[model samples]
Target: MRPSSDRQAPGGGPRDFAAAEWTKLRSLRSTWALLALGTVLTVLVSLLFCALIGPEFRRADSAQRRALDPVGLTFTGLQFGQVPLVILAVMAVGNEYGTGMIRTSLAAIPRRGALLTAKLAVLGATGAVWGLLTGAVALTAGSTVLGASVPLHTDAVRALAGAGAYTGLLAVLAAALTFMVRRSLTALGVLLPFLFVVSGALAATPQLRSLARLLPDRAGLRLTQVHQDAGDLSPAAGGGVLLLWAAVAATGSYVALRRQDC
Candidate 1:
């Protein structure tokens, strides 16, 4: 009988979890499409809005332009940009569950908590890098179109950084929810209403005004605006709120993943 060689299987390894995630991310057509859409939407809308408002401001007297927060003008597209961010984040996590790949993933990475953590780390890093480039491009392009000087104040820079952080953190949050809920469509159902309709309504309600400012979407929005409303939280405070949500969501996902079987 011939001796069988034992080196390693063609597929299995200690790094399989990360490799699997990388494959899933790259192979999924939606991932690339969504990312492209997010980038284009953010940059284009900012340019368009700036183009519309810039000429009007230029036509106005110096006094009128002085009163405007030029810094805020550059990020006007942030409001719309967030929609695609949420979608990308949601699909990243939710798709795994939807396709029943999480089970296979968990089986391979039996240390389920670690697997989720790795996923969050990978997505967060990707988000931060892409977001920084996108924000910088949008800000620069929008400023040129608007004919306004870019604000370099500490608070302004911090707020711009916060915008990138918010995108990455939200991506992790979306992933976590998928682990806990195991239902992509349902998670989106919950996420959408909470982000859009409910948050907007809450922000408008005087009775719920305090809580509304602390909500994830509301808080994240505040960070991108240079002019703080009377009731608006500071950009730093908004960052904290977003971070809190990311932490909570991540913890919840880890707990569920570890305790439950794939």
Candidate 2:
């Protein structure tokens, strides 16, 4: 009996790169763990904070005790949850390069661009699902305790949708940057400090608030809050900035891949 062929011709039939990537994504434990961690952190931490605020916390306007934006406060942990998403995204793409599996992936496809796209699609879809599930659960649980202080309206819906989108985008952008950097620790070191440390510092400075509005996570944070600063960047602008970052990172990775002879 003839042995089965393991090779696919270049530029042949529908590629099915999506299927290939889906298998790879699902096979990884880090992906699922990070997602679960993000959800738990968002829902549990937010709930704990709400409970701590209790009935004693009243607003200056006599609106209601614990009159904070329930929706926003509920999704507050996403700010921290985003860190794991970044780590997961980085590991997702970086693992291939780190393990030299990227060469094998390119060998199977022979078209590096197609391989990258497949990876992007898989990561993006996974992120979207993770974001939606986490946001929904957290919102539902947190709002139950917040009561009438939280409004049920179109604005609230938009904020929930925005949170999901932001989480997903965070994953994609981080993955792209990982591909560009091609090193797990290097990407994490650079991105973490920039997003968490640098952005936090800048946010504290009055003069830099306008500039800080341009930060990636800051724009994403707007998705959870009903009220935004006058100087804050719009969600649309934030999406554009993220897209630009993704594009640059992806392009850089592609160029490096082609030139590095890997």
lDDT of 2 by residue, 170-247 (tens): 777787777777889989988899888989999999899877877778876776666544676665676667666666
After superposition, which runs of candidate 2 have C-alpha atoms over 4 Å from their true positions?
1-15, 52-68, 149-152
Sliding window of 10 residues with minimal summed lDDT for model 2:
58-67
What is candidate 2's local distance difference test score?
0.74
Minimal lDDT window, size 10, model 1: 6-15
Q: How much is 222 displaced in model 2, in angstroms?
A: 1.5
Candidate 2 lDDT at 132 equals 75
lDDT agreement of model 1 with the native: 0.75
Residues 1-262, candidate 1: write the lDDT tens digits. Answer: 6665656436554366666676777787877777778788888988998898987878878767755656666676766676666677667777777777777777777677668867887677667666777777887888788887665676567657876887777777777777788777777888888887888899788999999888887786566666666777887788788889989999898888778755
